[model samples]
Target: MFKENMHTKVGFEMNINKDDVTAPDVIALLQDHLKSMTLCSPPESIHALNTDRLRQPDVTLWSAREDGVLLGCGALKELNSRHGELKSMKTSPQHVRKGVAKRILHHIIEEAKRRGYQRLSLETGSVEAFLPARLLYEKAGFQYCEPFGDYNEDPNSLFMTLNMR
Candidate 1:
């Protein structure tokens, strides 16, 4: 629960839960991330399979909140016994640079680890507009790599992975 225009109280409970991933909220977050990606690359650069796809049995959605406002949100898609994909990561424009992304990223990573996933991968952008996102991923221990899952090789996309072990 985030409070806009207010200070965050450290140790305040962040209600991170699965059911918080409402369709409307998740779609809004995806739209926001897509807009951010479009500023740097083509419209297709902001590719996310449909929200219905994320409704799969193996997919997990996590959201962060402080004081009732949405801070950031992300999803983890379990691929196999040891691998998971980072999907739909976004921080509200108002909350950017305020550690909201880091908090959500850490929460997703911990969730993946808790689920016994040994590896986590993500597909971001490869454009100047995405430097900050790339930096954030790197700061969170993600390293560049080739695209995985249904993604194909594209100079427009930057793929990264982290070893949860």
Candidate 2:
């Protein structure tokens, strides 16, 4: 029941919760993210996870809603006791540039810190269309880094990591 009234140009009552991923709005968001990723990267390089995968025990998913409108969603995947990864972060198309993604990202990073993770990392498409997302990560203190965990170097992918410790 975490709720915050975001006072921005598009001011909305943003509520963040670890809720069901099968919800209609959530499904739409995830589907849109997957479709967008596929458009920018090869199938083999698209790493966006499906709802079932995001529901795994190690992954904590949160959806942001504003007055019952799903604004965005993000997930923190525990990699180990001291590491975690950001996954499936997406904001509704209409909510873009309204601070929804930034709010969700801050929530995820705080959760990772609460879990005592020493590092938080993410993988995003290395394409022109993804520049905004990359800039968002950079603005949040994430720095370019080498591929981590099970990820490998791919020209279509970019890696970023934030030291939380």
Candidate 3:
């Protein structure tokens, strides 16, 4: 297990890696967390992310584990030159507001920066249930914008982007 020390809170030893995740693994985590979440209502479609379309080599899959226990997970999908997309960002309900998502977000963002991605973009739900996620993204310097990649105008979705340049 990988560990990173937090300022005061003892960070969990969560090893974010590629092969530790599967479609059912993601489904279980999300079904538990987003069942009643206002932000991520109807999380069933999220299962598709584990499919080949979203799990190709261009996509980087990550999961946080504590003592070999899975805690949370997220993914980064490289879109094109200098751009990347955030996908499947979810924290265990047990670890909500406990810096799990933040850690994963920072890890993915740092990976993107390391890979010379000039920009990072994300698509999240616009419902009230998703406020915490939106706040997290905003605090990470994500700003409102039109949908990136294949997304267009969507009332149910909120799109944001950050320039790493």
Candidate 4:
């Protein structure tokens, strides 16, 4: 469960690692992430994965921490030999706007590239609460796209993808 060190704009050294999703802090953060989803979207529209689903064989979760404090987490789920889905991306409430997500997002993109994935996609809420997330993905070069995999056209969901090749 170890990746590499990322130095932030604020000069703090953050560590991104392959996470097991068992640590108390990581579990607590995940609970908050799931609870937040409920506030903005109905159960039917919420696609964020729970802890059990996150541990599935096809998914790889990563955690970002600085000086032993958990800052954020994200996951990549292999949809096929050449495509992947970004899931459960969340930054701790106290760590928002601190570059934690940017670093983790960068790491996921690099890992997808390393895995020879042709594309990386994600589904986020279409509401205002998700504007920042959409902006982050857009800044990373992800573009609006049709839903991939098991997802269908739903007004509540916004799908985006990045071509890795």
Candidate 5:
């Protein structure tokens, strides 16, 4: 349940559910997320997953909805027994700045902990358009780090990781 605030509706009740990445609305939002990423970084630097790839067994996608309205979504991909990666994370355009992403992020972190992941990592753009995302991760204790797993160094990309201990 979200607190009633200036940005949220009076009876804001958010449900973060494990999604299959097949719903039409979820697909549309993911498309928009990919489109927005293309505008900010080159194709090689873009890491947001498409619907098909997000359905892989190693990945889990969660969507946040309030009163049946989609607010945002995020994904976690297990890298190994002790590691995980933050994949696609996007807030609906109308719901941006309404604490949607933050809540989803918190949910992801808790899930990672529950899964016994020792670390959670992510790759995001390094451009100004990604400032808000970078700040959000930083606020959640994610520290800048080197590329992990199958990634390589790229000027247009920034990698971060949180030590779960």
Candidate 6:
């Protein structure tokens, strides 16, 4: 089902819906995220998964649209029965600082809890361009944590987790 939230300040209809990740708008946003990541980190240090990987059975992707325009997207990958990893969070350039990311993130966290996950975690870059994202996660109650899932210690990565239980 498509869940919607109207932003009072913007007076626009924003909807968060589970998406197939193949729609043109979704692909464009994912591409933008990939391009931005490549600019900020080397190939080896970049861990953002491609579309094919995100289509796997364990991942559930969502896209946020405002008045039928794509605003952002994110995914939640089931790491285990009680754990999940947030992935591929990206807000469109025009939508940045307009609460799109926060809405998408809130949706992902709620979905994780609904699935009975005890914790949710994510790995993001440790660069200046990523400071806003780090702050967003921190504001959402995610705290620093050691590397999770298949992740290893990397100087260029910052891992964070939220306890859902």
Q: Write the per-residue lDDT of candidate 2 for residues 23-117, one digit (tens) a residue.
A: 98898889899998878899999999998998889998999988888999999999999999999999998889888888999899889989999
Candidate 5 lDDT by residue in tens digits, 86-156: 98999999999878998899899989999999999999999999999999899899999999999999999
Clashes of 2: 0
Reference-based lDDT, residue 58, model 3: 82
Instruction: After the best TM-score superposition of candidate 5, give how far the Cα of residue 145 lies from its true spot, in angstroms.
Output: 0.6
Report the lDDT tens digits of candidate 3 across residue range 1-165: 223345315654566676434557665874554444433545532322644544577877788777776678888888996999988787877767667788888888889899899999998877887788899898888899997788877677788998898
- Deviation in Å, model 1, residue 52 alpha carbon: 2.2
Candidate 3, after superposition: displacement of residue 113 in Å?
0.4
TM-scores of all models? 0.82, 0.94, 0.81, 0.95, 0.94, 0.94
Better of 2 and 3 by TM-score: 2
Query: Where in model 4 is the C-alpha error above 4 Å?
Result: 1-6
Clashing pairs in 4: none
lDDT score of residue 10 within candidate 3: 64
For candidate 6, write residues 1-165 as lDDT tens digits: 223354735576689999988998898889889999999998887988788888899999999987889999999999999999999999999988778888999899989989999999999999898999999899899999999999998888999999997
For residue 140, what is the lDDT in candidate 5?
Answer: 90
- Local accuracy by lDDT, each model: 0.75, 0.90, 0.74, 0.92, 0.92, 0.90
Tell me the number of clashing residue pairs for each predicted model: 5, 0, 3, 0, 0, 0
Candidate 6: global Cα-lDDT? 0.90
Q: Which residue runs does candidate 6 get wrong by more than 4 Å?
A: 1-8
Taking every candidate in turn, the Cα RMSD to the unseen true structure, in Å, is: 4.7, 3.2, 4.4, 3.4, 2.9, 3.2
Count of clashes in candidate 6: 0
- For model 4, residues 1-165, the per-residue Cα lDDT tens digits are 223335556578888999989999999999999999999998899899999999999999999988989999999999999999999899999998888888899999999999999999999999999999999899899999998999999989999999998
